[model samples]
Target: GAGVSQSPSNKVTEKGKDVELRCDPISGHTALYWYRQSLGQGLEFLIYFQGNSAPDKSGLPSDRFSAERTGGSVSTLTIQRTQQEDSAVYLCASSLVAAYTDTQYFGPGTRLTVL
Candidate 1:
């Protein structure tokens, strides 16, 4: 992809439902990250993936939120049994590499709303 791309710029679902968000990162990038931003809140790091190392899923709010990066390119974020409090923007970012100087490019993000 030319840049990070995220699908379903907006999503509205009832509480207790599940939703899947997709992200397509720039080609050849070796590092990908997912973050969440609740209304009036700052960015919250959700996960990080680089090469074959173990993914850093430490930031996931709970087991209800999960993600996977495949082939080092595309990624998906799934939120199960969503709650009204889950409403927020899910952002995806990618860097050419995970070095200290690497700049992460961000996607437009998916605005998820659990009604």
Candidate 2:
């Protein structure tokens, strides 16, 4: 399989709306991550998944943000009641294994806008 891929590379939504971002990790990768990058800022970790166990979701900004990985392959990040502050590029990455030193392959990211 190819590197991580995200759909709807760009999105625009009005305030209070909901949006879902998708991520497809590389085949056989056991660790997947989701991040958010604001304009001119570094990536901020949002959530992480390893195998099929519970996900590490401590980085989510608020209750409105959540994510899930199904079948240890594809993942989805959902933002409910979008706000202008939620506008940013959502990035996804995958690693061959779960290790602090593992190299992560990243997706291009989905740009979301809240109007």
Q: Name the top lDDT candidate.
A: 2
Q: Model 2 scores what on Cα lDDT?
A: 0.92
**lDDT of every predicted structure (CA atoms):** 0.90, 0.92
Span of 10 residues, lowest total lDDT, candidate 1: 48-57
User: Across residues 8-114, which tens digit of lDDT does each residue of candidate 1 receive?
Assistant: 99999999999999999888888989999999999999988895343577899999998887777888899999999899999999998887999999999999999
Instruction: List TM-score per model, in order.
Output: 0.94, 0.95
- What is the model-wide C-alpha lDDT for candidate 1? 0.90
- Per-residue lDDT value at 65 in model 2: 95
Sequence-dependent TM-score of model 1: 0.94
Q: Could you tell me the lDDT of residue 74 within candidate 1?
A: 88
